[model samples]
Target: MSFNESVLGKEYLKYCNLKEIALNTKTLDLSNISWFFPTCLLPLGIFIKEHKEIHVIPPIDIEVAKYFNIIMKDKIDSVKRSYIPIVEILPNKKLIEKNLDSLISNKDYNMGSLNAFAYFIGELITNIYEHSKFSTAYIIAQRYNQKNFTEIGIIDNGISIPGSYEIKGFNFSDIKALEEAIQGLSTKYNDNEYSERGYGLRTSLNLLTEGFEAKCLIVSRGVGLIANKNNRFFYKMKEKDIFNGTLISTRFDNNIREVNVYAYIDT
Candidate 1:
């Protein structure tokens, strides 16, 4: 069980069961419910006071599905249903800006961490706009804790990153392409705009160490997957089609314990 898995699992067990009980109760306590809801429990919290039955949508783990079903089983026939806990569904361009706003607004993130997040988000959105030509992209942002830890995901239905690279004249497989991308190599962009070549991908990875402690999971075209943390790197995706385009998730320290957001700028 990884850190997030443990956190989410605990939340699933607590909240799913609570929603079953809270549905029938006339008045529900918001603070008490926060225990189970955690930061990840969003829009679902909207129905905490009124809904009697809660059904969590699928595309989640089987264990979570089983327990979620168990909680809703007896609560069936209830007149109350709520939307998914997701905050907002965003397109590619807006998602990056929105995440930057979030990173800036939250007081828990420092400028360095916030900047790192901003750059990472920039790279991701750029990848989407630059690669996924099939459809508009969709991104979801969720805050999971007060400790400066947040999860942001950008999803697209277009071909995966590796596929995009192949289309761009790269014959390499997923792992090969991903490695190149993370290490600062580029199929299209220069390695370093300032240093004479492509550097966005590599620069972002390097920033993980210099500025703060962070972890990133990148699934791109020919690049199957990779993650970097504490100066050590690991492979997370192996011959798996996470999706077309890429899904980049990162957790970083916000640099500051408090951020006004309005004052934080890229300049």
Candidate 2:
């Protein structure tokens, strides 16, 4: 609920601390601590959701305790939180795509741009699979049934943003990679129907910050970028920071009433 740079910075520090503790105990839990930013929950969720050897406790807010599986439905039912385990996508990709296509809130978005949200989500997932060279990847989400708010997070244990750029023969510092990504500079040679290679992340960032008037956070390697409704800036993390892979998290408020996805995504 209290999500901002100051609060997120503290949570990031907490994430780093927990990462160190994870090495020793192999036990991670953050259910009790109220979140500063919903994205802060992703790193822990992605790591423990896969490794069964790691002991964990379920949280009421987000079901970090449950083993993640591809959700054919969007609602966060009592059975499980909305999530798609990275491993679940490969063997059943066709079926998973069908489910994801229907998973977005059909009622929340305007009909004209309804598919845009799903397209963005699918594009990011596709990028991770085709590019990340990830041993582990995950998508975790939380919805406050009481409020008009929902948050989704995607993360991976693959090459960070700079590494992705390097893989494409583009050498950039971590910050530069992130900056270019926000500027819609993709490492892919192929282009999507709507835009060039980098449409997914850049467009999503615009949709969240510009369209929805909300905040979006992207952390890659040790660098973090915080994009808010009016302003965007980068936060350089300390060398000892934990979690090297890219982390992206954002929220959608159904109460916003008007969101122009096309305004941000060039068709």
Candidate 3:
């Protein structure tokens, strides 16, 4: 199957289709996909790695092929799993912090921006544990000195944003759920203290766009959002494929500095 942004969905069907293809075939071809999203790209990498026999045919799109090569470079040359282990359950916050610290330390970039990026990563991952019903989550990160940017991808196969809110008794469409999420609204009713709910996505976006002048792309269900320092916009997928959960990809400029990580996380 040719994977593209249009085939991205929030139901189990899309994932199932990929899994079926992987299981039945020794070599999975991706040459047909001209354009792609990290939401699908990251999880597809994880899925392929899990199934050792499956070989991926490079995408026809040169840029897409380059991205896959960069993110999975360690895997491309070796059979060993070099990337961080997939977290099947909520990981300990301290462990995550330690990992982030190590990840940041390896980068020769602005300390303040790195710190903010670390915080943003922590929050985004934490959201998966707090909000989703899924058991597994995948993260992939790469720093491109030539491109002068650092990219991080987090993905999960679970109940989507709208599905989670619906379970909490709020009826809304996928786009509405995404809109509310970016606005810092939560399905959890907290009359006395707003802090008790709904700060993950908004605060993470603030740190990325406002704090570091970064760019973020979030895809869930049938809606996708892209935000940067100057503006934020949303687009609907053409096929209405349910994605079962969420995928967030962020890119932070290596040149950014003077970020107030504490303030963003606290507020």
Which candidate tops lDDT?
Answer: 3
Off by over 4 Å in 2: 1-13, 29-38, 49-92, 105-113, 190-195
Kindly give the stretch of ten consecutive residues in candidate 3 with the minimal lDDT sum: 75-84
Query: Count of backbone clashes for each model?
Result: 30, 0, 8
Report model 3's TM-score to 2 decimal places. Answer: 0.70
Cα RMSD for candidates in order = 11.3, 5.1, 6.4
| 1 versus 2: better lDDT goes to | 2
lDDT tens per residue, model 2, 15-97: 67766676578876645654433455557655565556777544445533242222222332234333222222332346556
Candidate 3, 97-122: lDDT as tens digits: 54444444544656676677667767
The C-alpha lDDT values of all candidates are 0.44, 0.62, 0.64
What candidate 3 gets wrong by more than 4 Å, as runs, is 1-27, 30-40, 46-101, 191-194, 263-266
Candidate order (lDDT)? 3, 2, 1
lDDT of 1 by residue, 1-267 (tens): 232233332333343344445455643333333122222232233233235444333325554443223223322111111111222223445644543454334344456456655665566566666666635343334354455455554445467656766787878767777766666555564443322123565665555433444555554532433344443333433222233455454444434243232232222
Structural similarity to truth (TM-score) of each candidate: 0.52, 0.75, 0.70
How well does candidate 2 match the true structure in TM-score terms?
A: 0.75
lDDT comparison, 1 vs 3, better candidate? 3
